[model samples]
Target: MSNIIEKNVDLLKKANVYFDGRVTSRNYTDKDGVVKSLGVMLPGEYTFNTKAPESMEILGGKVEVLILSGLDNNWETYGAGETFEVPGNSSFEIKVLELADYCCTYLS
Candidate 1:
């Protein structure tokens, strides 16, 4: 991923708050027409639903996750500079091991 992004962004206010406000995000579209979002997750367990295939890169801290149809009930850990993918029409449970900062790409 590039180290830079657009300066201006649209905030998703009044919605997209999850885990009782423990997670929050702001989304933006790039010049190439790809959609992405920056999000922060406080220390908590959270579940996220996806409308499209999503790729998330951890920018800070760490997370352990159990994806829908995850292998052998396995839970995977990811940290800064690591990435994970979730298929569209699925859900994943994430345990925030630390204050995690992430950027996600929404892929159609």
Candidate 2:
């Protein structure tokens, strides 16, 4: 609770629960009912399986991602303040260039 504040209703710590301890996140819902997660990733390559459309924003550092349904040629690079979208029922691969910080929204 110390690291949380008002309306920051969800907090998910990296306690080896998901992604084999590779990722950690804090979930919250805004006033408009938009659900989002603020998360961090260590320097590494990661693949995420998606069941719903997702919008991702990079908060710090950079990453190269391969979204099978979107990008054509090769992995695309995204840096701080950059964003991208991935479709539902698909998968995306991400390579973190640094300690990547990000926010992700699941769209219905």
Candidate 3:
């Protein structure tokens, strides 16, 4: 996928701050009306609950993820250019090995 999204995007000016500012993201909607967020996470561990099915692309840095559902609950590592999916109405634990940049696309 391309790194740049050049047009027809509606971005919110305010950020969605979480974990006491350890994580921050800006919400945006694409031309196709897909809700997405571009965010950065500082080196730390965090748990996030999802309301919608999400596709998380790792833009930079390394992270270990453990999805908190289903029988196969193992920590998987992902780095830049990798992607993972989280089920709707579920949660996951993430350990950011370094400062990480990510983009989250909410699926319908």
Q: RMSD to the native, candidate 1?
A: 2.3
Of the pair 2 and 3, which is ahead by TM-score? 3
Per-model TM values vs. the true structure: 0.85, 0.80, 0.96
Find the candidate with the highest lDDT and give its number: 3
Per-residue lDDT for 18-47 in model 1, tens only? 767799887777667688888899999988
The residue ranges of model 1 lying beyond 4 angstroms of the native Cα positions read 4-15, 70-73
Give each model's whole-structure lDDT: 0.85, 0.79, 0.94
Better of 1 and 3 by lDDT: 3
Candidate 3 similarity to native, TM-score: 0.96
100, model 3: CA deviation in Å?
0.5
Better of 1 and 3 by TM-score: 3
Ten consecutive residues with minimal summed lDDT in candidate 3?
1-10
Model 3 per-residue lDDT at 103: 94
